[model samples]
Target: MIRAADPSDAVAIARIYNQAITDGSYATCDLKPVSAESRIDWLKQHQPPYPVFVWENQLGEVIGYSALSPFSIRPSYRSIAEVAIYVDQAQRRGIVGGRLLIHLMKTAKKLGFRALVALILEKNQSSFEAAIGLGFQRVAYLPEVAKMKQQWEGVIWVQKDLTASSQ
Candidate 1:
């Protein structure tokens, strides 16, 4: 099941996100593990059109999470949003991330977003393929834009035009 995230889900969200951060999975650029308290503050920033959603198991554990965040502060970019997803390492091979992302996409469209963008690491082919399978198109590539552990890496920018999809 997937639902809007609340303050209480911070801990589980942090755990799943930290897994990506620590495992060198190239899934995220965050270098440090986030605290649950800080995640609560992050959760507070996401409201209405831009909100965080968590995937919960039958036992009510948060196994994955996704969110639509403001793509930019400029008024001209208000119609676009950036999407992010993180799932527990144990659930990475499953459909958790895909489901969470699909949910986020539908919510973004219904909330008036014209496009949703995902910035994926160049080495994270699984995530790239998943995003493409969900209808996101690669729009740009930034080479050697990120330095992770003294090594340079690139980022792939993918976008989904919500207007082309059925409401």
Candidate 2:
């Protein structure tokens, strides 16, 4: 099931996130995993309009999370949002990521967002394919945008319009 994330879900989310960082799929730093306290602080700071959603299993464990943050600081960009999704390694191919993404898209539209953008690492084929399957179009690609673990990585920018009301 997918639902709004609570402070209690922080540890699980942090664990999965840290695992992604370690696995090289996400290309993040090797810092210590974020604590629940920090997650609570983050949740408190974001306020109402912005939200974070999590995918949960039958055991109530958090398998993945997706969030929508402001796409740009300009006032004219207020209707756009940047989306991020991360899933537990074990749940990679189980559709958890897809469900979380779909939920984010629905929630973003309901919250009056006009568009949703995804910044994806080039090597992450699964994520790119998932976004394409969800109707997101690749609008740009930045070659050698980031250097991770001594290797250069590219980034793909994908977008989807959410202005059309859902039937």
Candidate 3:
């Protein structure tokens, strides 16, 4: 099940995200594992139009999470939002990530966002392809944007139009 994340869900969210950081999957550029306390603050940043959601298991554990953040601070870009998703290492290559993304898209449209964008690491083919499968179009490719583990890696930018007609 997916629901709005509260402070109580911080630990599990951090655990899932930290696993991705340590697994070297290049799912995220964040180099350090975030603390539960820090995640609480991060959750606070996502309010109203922007939100943080968690995918919970039958046992009530947070197995995955997704968030919509400001794509750019420029006032002209207010209609565009950036997306980020992370699934538990144990649940990789499963339906969890895709479902979270789909949910985010719906929520973004409802929140008055005209478009949603995702910046995926070039090396994470599965994630990049998943976004494409969900109707996001490749907008651009940023070369050597991040240096992970002493090696430079590129990024792929994908965008999904959220206008009513897109549905």
lDDT (tens digit, per residue) of candidate 1 on 25-118: 8999888889999999999999778899999999999999999999999999999999999999999979999999999989998899999999
On a 0 to 1 TM-score scale, where does candidate 1 land against the true structure? 0.97
Colliding pairs, model 3: none
Give a tens-digit lDDT track for model 2, residues 1-167: 88888788888877877887778785243345676678777666556577988888999888898888888889999998988888989889878888888999888888988899988888888889999999899999999977777887888999998866551
Predicted structure 2: clash tally: 0
Which ten contiguous residues of candidate 2 have the minimum total lDDT? 26-35
Candidate 3 wrongly placed segments (more than 4 Å)? none
Question: lDDT for model 3, on a 0 to 1 scale?
Answer: 0.94
Candidate 2: stretches off by over 4 Å:
27-33, 165-167
Tens digits of lDDT, candidate 3, 20-110: 8999899999999999999999999998889999999999989999999999989999999999999998888899999999999999998
